[model samples]
Target: MRRRDLLASAALPLPAWASAAPERVLRVGTDIAEVGFDPPRVSDRTSVTINAHIFESPLTYDYLARPALLRPQTAAALPEASENFTRWVFTLQPGIFFADDPAFGGKPRELVAADYVYSIKRFFDPRIPTEHLFHFENAGILGLSELRQRALKAKTGLDYDAPVAGLRALDRYRFEIRLARPAPRFVQLFAVPGLTGALAREVVEHYDDELPAHPVGTGPFMLQRWRRGSQVRLVRNPRFREQHFDSLATDLNAEDQALLKRLQGRRLPLVDAVEVNVILEEQPRWLAFHGGEIDVLELPPTLAPAVMPGGRLAPYLAQRGVQARAQVDASVRHTFFNCEDPDIGGLQPERVALRRAIALAYDNTEELRSVFKGQGVPAQSMLVPAVYGFDATLRSAAGSGDMARARALLDTYGYRDVDRDGWREHPDGRSLTLRLAGLSDSRQRAINELWLKKMRLLGLRIVFEPGQFGELIKNSLAGTLQMWSYSWTTSQPDGDFFLALGYGPNAGQANDARLVLPAFDRAYEKQRALPDGPERLAAMRAANRLMLAYQPYLPHFHALRVDLSQPGVEGYRRHPFTRDWWRYTAKE
Candidate 1:
């Protein structure tokens, strides 16, 4: 598990003199952008890279634990429910406005019900591509299933409008929802970033094509311009409410002191302007941040200086004491396999075979120490300890490959040395070897090479292959390649869904290594139907038992994200799938 205790212990209390004074401008550094302005269409971390000032969500996540809620953020008090758990209502805080309204000309918008309805319906919009649709399935939203089927089939048209029986536009401030069954997290689901953000139907309708590059929401900031594939800029939301910071601050917290010093009645956009610059390479960014040209850097493993060079960052780290402000999901990063191999289930054991071979071949320990620099724990299964369906008791003994075991498995499976030669042969006497393909990035290429060396030792002939990241991902999804490393960014804490959910097209789609275990599917179906809590948790455990019995992929480690920022940046946070979560964070 991540050393959460260390982060909590290192936390300092805010000084009593703290106050929310105004400030302006937050300059940011980011990588490349994906596409889409609408939240539902966005899946890549760098794609939604905007500031909190420009965007906001109705349901905010409570840091204590991740579950969505009806409030803008997770609340100390859970929402109250009616007698039958049938009708769900949420009351929003009084005054809020969108960031770029000409009415406020750049004010936040008041939260309301229709906004939620619009957000929910977008999933069913053939035009809108929301990877989070599974989250909306059980809300008892009218015509959801039919709409989803049509949307998935046609990929456009608002056939879902007529099915509004389960959802309502109860006045302006309050929203009501009916659930088919009780989901404790149905309300909290709204708090999550992608799930509950309310969108103005007018804006989405007007600039539908331009939404991705130009974000419009009731957050603290608004998008001014996006220099595609390069950088983005934002201006503060003039009508931002909740000027007070989150109450979790302590007097000694470094952020409190910094906020106090930076916000002293300054104009919004504290500086002349804020820029979220995109840099694909790491060296230039560190040089800029070090030279004081840049204010913050979301340094990844490939970006962080392994040996703090010359003690240059010592004072800055100590004096600033600003740390990564997000929950590190151990499950966020892992390889997806091509579970759909025909023979793997047809002529051969498709998923289970690949999983067994890859797991046994991978040196998770070495990757954890060398690549991650001991910043992360190795994951042996799809679900990490933090996520549901994860079996903590399952210790992987695969990396310790024994030729005896490898030979035994291959011999029984038909890849045996029937011919008296160095190379093994399949039952049909064909060469028994395959190539491992992965990203050509220096770090990944290096790791891939190491795995190749290890796999060769297991009496298997190995070839190291390189391809463009996108192409490799495409091939993995199509099941065209034998073995490749794949990544699913927004993996859930209780994720067995990628394998069980029937979306066969989401690139490097989860369940790529299609195992087709009925018991696993049944357990997952049970899991999917349950609200995201203990009952779902129990069903997921049973499913994990199925995963353990049938290994599906060579599970890898979640990347431990490391970033460097100058002092005075506050409210910068992270999410499960990203190290580059840009928007929703404020700067002094």
Candidate 2:
């Protein structure tokens, strides 16, 4: 709906903060444009970051928890699990209401347990391309998958009214979920507000296909304006419930202690508005922050050494009263080969040899030094630090750089310069060329140049296909991209999702590589089913070995996240799990 139409539809006064002073508006920059606000349809970090403020989930991570601890958001308390983690129940906080919307007929709308139930069911609806369906499918929610398959075979929309034995609202403010298998960490799914936020059925039915633009939820902020690919403005929700800043963390640094002392009982969303601009280039974004136009910045790696030398704020920035916080992120950057592609995919000996050769030739150290400014640690395995199932003792050759071994493997696989053109050819003398998809940015160009040099050293011809990140994500999901390099960050402390990249069932979702090895899938399932112990560790290690042997993905490095805030911005801290930190900060 147009702004005028939307305003005319509601008979309500503007929020008090709507006319507050301009300083109440906090401005920030994103490195890329968001895909959209539709949680189910989005898989990118930028979109999820923006949506998290406008949506509320059952649970959220504590702001100061180091390893990341989950706490209740809309829920009255932590969920109760029983029956060996097969059944879970959640009780919603009473009297909570969604942000005002025309779908509510201009009357206050109370949030209920049914809203959460309907929101999750939307993922199974065939009409929607839910990128996180693999998460729900992996949970083995009873009868839900069958309902989806039934709709698929019937060629019709899912019967949302159909009573699934496993998923149902027990009452107006409580719901129950029964799973087919044990899921000890299933509650972690509740912490992802962007994907699992509650949505009223009426609002969904009203907007229909336009739900992405018309998001209504019981969150602190509501979308005020959106200029696609340029900027977005979010204002405090007029009907947001009263909540105070609090944490259960016992161990906090002096900085957090001071922040808590000042803002402990203050009403949330200290800022009245959040304005996010899509600044794709690092130079422009860095300049914006340096000039005080941007309130917070992640501190681009290219400028990190000069701006915040030795992991501390430069003297000049500190003189300006700027504050900085840094931590090694729970993320892994990697280059993935589409296992379905004919040239570098499949289990055939020659195809596997080609992929292994490429993996061996990758230079992680040079890329880290040149592109990341030596601000990250070389990734030893798929799992990064601080996540469960990560074993520092386990060593793998996936991150190793060896040109000699790569050349010998190619030679043994019959890849040679048949025509003496300094580029290798297939066993039958067909020219070999590899295409790598990446964002069209200077950082990506630098990384791609590294790949170009590495491939040339191995007598292989390689080309970089540059495009917008959103379009590249679509190509990756479709399994059409030959290869691509990107980072995968953990949403929950458990790092199983990283291994899910190779799970046979996740091919069209998180598994961009399209790998479907039965052995790897077995190990992955085993680890998920077992409790956290030596048995589970062994299972995960076995799966990691399969990934290294197949060379489906060449792990790069784990980045160090360094964020800086302007002088008067208070209570700014980066959480490893959640992205909705705007609520905890204020600007002077």
Candidate 3:
């Protein structure tokens, strides 16, 4: 039903349950500040978390599914895929309206297939700086890349009115996308709300460069207030179409089954509002949780020993009705060396040996024990355990720390203390020093100390260059930083996103290491066209081996995420694939 039809009645009566109950609010916290609300413009997890609530995608993950099943969101059903996996069709649900906005002149605007088409086009516009352009380029979306190239060469804006063979709206409620090559895992893009959400053309044109501040969508929630990097507030969208809580809930454990029972038919956005505070410090976030200012807390690794002694919730917290849940997050942390940096960059044997020695010398075990408090497992490759094409039996010397081997490799590469300065010199007798870019947080300082110790033990000079997290990201993308440490969390169940980190075309975007090996890129593309079987898996492994052989990035470990919730918070569960959980949770 249309929103006006439902809200037209002036004397409508409220339900007994809603009329008698107090306003429900869910308070949450994040360790990082949000960069912006615009989905395509931002890549940070904090911004994505906020954008997920204010945007509507074609599909979303089932809330109660363990294996991350996909379900239709704005669409009436799952997309229809062609036999060759090149074409996809989606039919939008009728009568769904965007949140009330000035762009619509105070009238409710219905969502249509064109909104999604325009949103996709936004990523290809040369004027917009988007990090996601690589994915669509890699997907070989029919004429989109050629159009983008034309715009770039012409030094003009993308001709939105121009027709493209690959992307088109079939009708008012239906759209089609045709890829040039097979992409079996391409459907996963529909499930990512933050990356592929529909955007109204009217709203985009009305706001222009200010669109990030004015996000209007057909989701269950609408942005009420935003304080840049400080805080974000969202309220239930009164014009949202009727949607009840329902899921397949397949293979759920006993605890999840009970949760499904409780939330089976509840209206979405069970809480009236959601308030997220940007708390960058660990101690303050913990204090806010303990003081009841925040209803949910993602416990930091440094505090794990105190809150979860011996991997169990403490008695004092349990007695107070606090609950703890821990899961191995589908993420991989690594220190990447800039393959384009003049100092440590190149395919020369000496340069490759230097990187391999450094990777061999760094100890993942020590980092997991000291910094993570035994909250992670050593990572064998860029592929995390939660995705396909991950081989647990795969082994590599790059991930295992061996001081003796590292020294021998350095010696073989002509690196030695030529002047007896207790530091290694380059093959040409030039002073060698490694500069690592890091954040200014206390946690980062601890990690940097470990890096310093490891490098010093090998008689290699290392220095720390600390800056804000966002600043480091910019510098890394510009290929100005020699090395930087960070983590990437997968948003899809496919391993392609992780492997894209080494693809040459993704240099300034996903490939922060700027690795430009043609062989690895060939293997990555070859696997994308193959079916998901032993052949595809072998291709993925070959690509991974090429990356490991070069040693552009030293794999660290996969972190374990620990979450604590107050007794009043109900229906809260950490999803393995999605980050937006506020709509499913409520506070007493």
Candidate 4:
């Protein structure tokens, strides 16, 4: 059977219990300040940390792991981008009512196609400072650049009088957008992590003259209050819609076999309130989860072993009557090399050889077993283990670790012990010395130490260039640092997307290694051009070979995600790459 067919065929079976339940209140704890509630502002991790309470996308994923259109109007009906990848159309869901807001002294108007267009435009708005615009690069909407320019003007048009970019309101219930490609998943892009509730065009217009303080979005919860650097709070938009895509809960799937079957005609929500609090340090969260002050914990590293099945917290978790899960997520955690920096010595082939040598010398297995407690699998190649075909032959090409062989590569490249002393020297006449900058995290520090030790053994001088994390990030990205070990995360299921593979234009700057091969560039571009899945996979296999052949990066560990819910709070499942929603979630 075809893979996608096998995947789709494994749907959930019918449930026996069927009963309407009340709303649910979910409380989650965090450890830092998030950028803000507005989706287009900054891709701040802390802010989007809480789900259900704020920010909703149009379509969402289902328990079976398929992209389930959340808006009733979108179900089984959204249009596909044409064969040339240039257009898409969608019908607005009907009979939907925004939760009535007494705070408005009135009711919100019915959602329309115009709202979707405006929400999309907000991302391109320069004033928004969207740190993650790559999500929309392939959107291929015409006149989008002009719209972005208008949105970016110091003071500009915040509302649409007429239509642009082939965008038009075909009456109040339907909308269309012409694209530059035959985007198969274009409509589903709305279901990805980037979309948010429609903002009030008037609210943005009112604040156009000044910087936006509090942007309004239509979701289950509204920004009730924000105390900068301290805490932010959201109250149930008594006048809101029960949107399942509320950003906080957007990526976390809420699944219950019995609840799903029982919810056919049932009204959603079992609890009255959902609260999110910011607690920045790990200790308070550890205490709170035990005290039952928070229903869900993001599972920090120190806490990973205890509540997890294998580590120190295993005994405690069992005694506490908690359920456990270890997700081998697609998030490929890796160490990035600053290949372009001149200070790291020559921008050409010299640096490439040294970088490749460093990648080979380190043992990934020891790091996983000792530091990550055998939880991480080696990133022999780019694609995550289960999502795509990893092509074992390609993985085998990574070549086992041989310190002597690695030294020979450096020697071949003219890096040899000229002084006849222990340390090697650059053939260009410079000493073989390099400084590595690393993060303060215990796990990261450990990795850095391992690399330093291995490099030292291979006849090189190594140093740890430490500083405040904020400055470390600044210097690292700007390429002032020679070597770095940092964490890269993702929620995308397929390695074919721009995140892991695509190069040139959103090929992903966060790659940290910042190396782009001509071969990879060709393969990435070709893979997307193919309309068939099998063909795309074939190109990706070739691309994966090109990526691993050089070994630009060494993969470390997977993000460990765990959920702890009180007895009354049921129905929380780990969300896969496509961020899922939670309207059907209920409490006993």
Candidate 5:
């Protein structure tokens, strides 16, 4: 597709009443573009945000609850777990039917246990090539990995017709999963939209390789229209199962409580439609929200000062009756050094020292102050708030830059300006330059400039390779990038979720850095096997300290997420993990 076409929404004819007051539409503006709607194939945040509305998982986190509470979605109730935690059985709620599609041969197909079994197996199918397969692979699900291997060697691809022993449909509504070992946290994995949403077999077979373009699910909304990379529109599913606003004892403020009271007893999916515009630039997105073209806006860090000066609502915005909410986001941004590269990789003493020195020289506080405009706190470690094993007392050795120490370490490692041109050369006297990949945005450019200034002070040369966020992720996964800046937002509240990024087995998957350390890998395994308690906490702490010593990633800031909504909009709550807020939102 042409660039212009990819960046433009289709100009559909508007209804006669489209311009009338307060249409039941919740419009959203997001800076990042989506990859596609395919649940199993997509891993980006933008795509996941869109898909969350179209798909329903067996379980989900409570929408209004703080500290996140798990609740059943398609499942009749929580799964019955065995004493050893090796087996789990779930019963689906009756009368849940998929959205009407030609794949179903003009018949209404009720969601069944077999559909979930088929959906999850697609993650392991080589034909689909899902990046999230590692989540299930590490769960030690009996016979699943073996089944995938068998399909890989067979002439035909994954046999959706065949069944695996671990994933069995006990009846029309009930299914059981048997694991090789105890996975107490396995149930939480289902709450992730892309990881465990139900997929109809006929729909998969009908679309085949084109499944990304044709997503059919049994959620509150259906993808009515999509102009890839530019815009997406979702209409309420007429056949959606009847679900109401469930109550929870949350720490909601008076305003939040008032909004919830107005929404109580109302059937879910209060809005008639949802419209999302993909505005790549933050300025345009903010402007769209300001001009009343969009109902809700996520205030970017670069514009936080103008929107919410001094961490409070700006006077102009407050006078316009805009409500703003700001909280520390459950995420971490960092730059990763590819462990597979010869220049920056490996556990050698010199390489380790060089990496640690670079980390020490990068000033996170400056980035937060200037780039973020005081919208975030300097991250002490990889662990973000709300996740287990995040030690408030623990601090990173490289949190503050130590220029004197950084220079001494480089000089001792033979990385010196041999030619006296004010630039350092490799220990072997070869021309040395570090390449860092980043998005071609003003904010990223500013960040790159900061890094360049720091590197220049140390007599080192660094270059920024600009590309789209999708391209950067592709290159990182391929292990072609030497160093790159990225962020990870946990879908579940587990320390293992972040620590698993350094595991050797997850290379090119979750471990984008391609780190391979046996000691760290062992620690990760030990922590995953234990239940959430002191034992697991101790193991995770050791693993985190080991990563800190290795210095593969320079810990960055955990910025506060700022959200703005017009006063007319109601029942719009921000979730820490799930992004499916459109269903509960409505405009007066």
Candidate 6:
């Protein structure tokens, strides 16, 4: 059967129970295809959004909390930490069972502490080579790094039976983690979906390397069907444990209170199913939502003016009973220079001067107004609002750009039009050309044109090399791209991950810029050990200043997140850090 026909057939209503409430289903339209379902192997936002519903992390952030408060999800309670903060212990909630799978030999498999230990150890296995290994590597776990090296050297592959001292299971329900040093923010790691979600050994062994296709978890939903790159459907898990909505202690507005009252004490997973369609273009996704084919719409910034003029929903949309909510997202979009490339890399004075001059010449404010249609704010520093250590007083030196100063800096560094071709050449009389790796989308094309126009004013010539997102990521990780544009969204309300992106050890992993700075390394290490206070904030500020001085990334703007939903959709709230928010949502 055709792909669309298959999906349409799957949506046919199921027989309803006489006493049970009617089933509610949510249909979401997205412009990007999910890379995979395996949390450790996939790092893209689309994949994370899809997998989060199927996996249960040890800890999760409150859905409606404004400042992002962490709460226990699968655990009975928050883990207990030692006085020095090096050792922590957690006990799992009893009676939790994994979804039914043939790998279990027809018996329901109960989730245990050993499952979490095995899941974390997978990050260190050289065969899997999970991209998120850096998060664990930086935590100073005693034997993890050594075990990874040992497995790489062994003739045979990793032995899942081997026990590591740093990660141990005390019993079926309890486990402890020992860090080499004090890490005050260690608990935050548990909130990441890739880090704490439990995976059964039997399931992993059955699926082997193709585990992304088979996902077994103890969350509210289970993967029912997936037509790779076309569509995916998730049905409510039959073995999911009972859970109810609880009120928060934090202050909430009137609207939020009303939402809470309606949902309090109600069984979770208000929706019975979720259906996602992959439409890799903004116009089609937007149209799908407008035609009532999808329930929720995440409007792109480029289309903000046409759909929401003056930052408000258009009258036509309002008349259709569509509600709009917009807020500045906790993310920073910028262009990263490959510090390993000889032309744009290094810490010499001339190299720094060139980077700073380029920063000064490019205009972010104009792009925010023209390309983004006033839907974004100029980024002052790497740290966005709401994250700890973000100082409101800190500002970027060339955020708005000083054209005159940029010209002077370039001329002083001997970058001039020597051959009179109206473009600058290398200071040493060598040819100089910068190639930017980009995606061939309308929004990216418009942004690239603006960048080209601004760089031309500095007598510099730049060319765009367009490719797929996956190809760009591969090239960036290999350090083959001279420059590229990317963005990072915070998964927690802390600045450690953002600062760790430039650390030396993360070169081929999270540090796509390949920046190696000893100063940044020391500050980051010190900051991670200290609790949230003035001292840690000071260390984070110092690191931010050093990154600005090095100029590895030309600061860009932080865009706004605009969401639209039909009036019938209730209990909908946007989370700053978490995705897969369908559990608390329902439609009339």
Residue-level lDDT of model 2, residues 1-588, one tens digit each, is 474355333334447656766648888888978877878898777888888898898999998767688899999999999998999999999989999898999999999999999999989998888668988899899999999999999999889999997899999999999999988888999999866788889998998866777778888888877777778778888888998898877888888788888888889989988889989899999999999898988889999889878877899989999888888898999989999997788998899999989988887888898899987988877888888888888776654779999999999989999999899999889888999999888999899888888899999999989888778888888889999999998888886878998998999888999999999999999899888889998999899889888888989999988888998899887788887899898887
True lDDT of residue 116, candidate 5: 86
- What's the distance in Å from true for residue 131, model 3? 1.5
Better of 3 and 4 by lDDT: 3
lDDT of each: 0.55, 0.87, 0.86, 0.56, 0.83, 0.82
Report the C-alpha lDDT of model 4 over 54-80, residue by residue, as the tens digit: 444555555443433233322234454
Instruction: Write the residue-wise lDDT of candidate 6 on 1-588 in tens digits.
Output: 454354344332333441287667788777767777778877777788877888877888887777788888888999999959889998899899998887899998998999888888888887774557888889888788888888888855567777777899999999999989898888988887767788898999987766787788988888877777778888888888999987574689888888888888889888888888887778888888889999887887778988999888999999999988888888888888888888878888777888888888888898888877788788877777778887788778665767888889989999888899998887887667788888888888998998888888888889999987767777787789988886788787988877887788998888887889999889888898898899988999888888888888886877688888877888765687887688888888
Q: Which residue runs of candidate 2 sit more than 4 Å off their true CA positions?
A: 1-14, 20-23
TM-scores of all predicted structures: 0.77, 0.96, 0.95, 0.78, 0.95, 0.95
Give lDDT for model 3. 0.86
Candidate 1: tens digits of C-alpha lDDT, residues 269-314: 3342467777656567666666666676666554344423332344
**How big is the positional error of residue 144 in model 2, measured in Å on the Cα after superposition?**
1.2
The clash count of every prediction, one per candidate, is 59, 0, 0, 28, 0, 0
Residue pairs clashing, model 6: none
Specify the poorest-scoring 10-residue window by lDDT in model 1: 10-19
Higher-ranked by lDDT: 3 or 5: 3
Candidate 6 Cα misplacement greater than 4 A, ranges:
1-22
Tell me the tens digit of each residue's lDDT in model 3 across 211-278. Answer: 77778888877877777567777878888788888889779888888888888998888888788899
Candidates arranged by lDDT, highest first: 2, 3, 5, 6, 4, 1
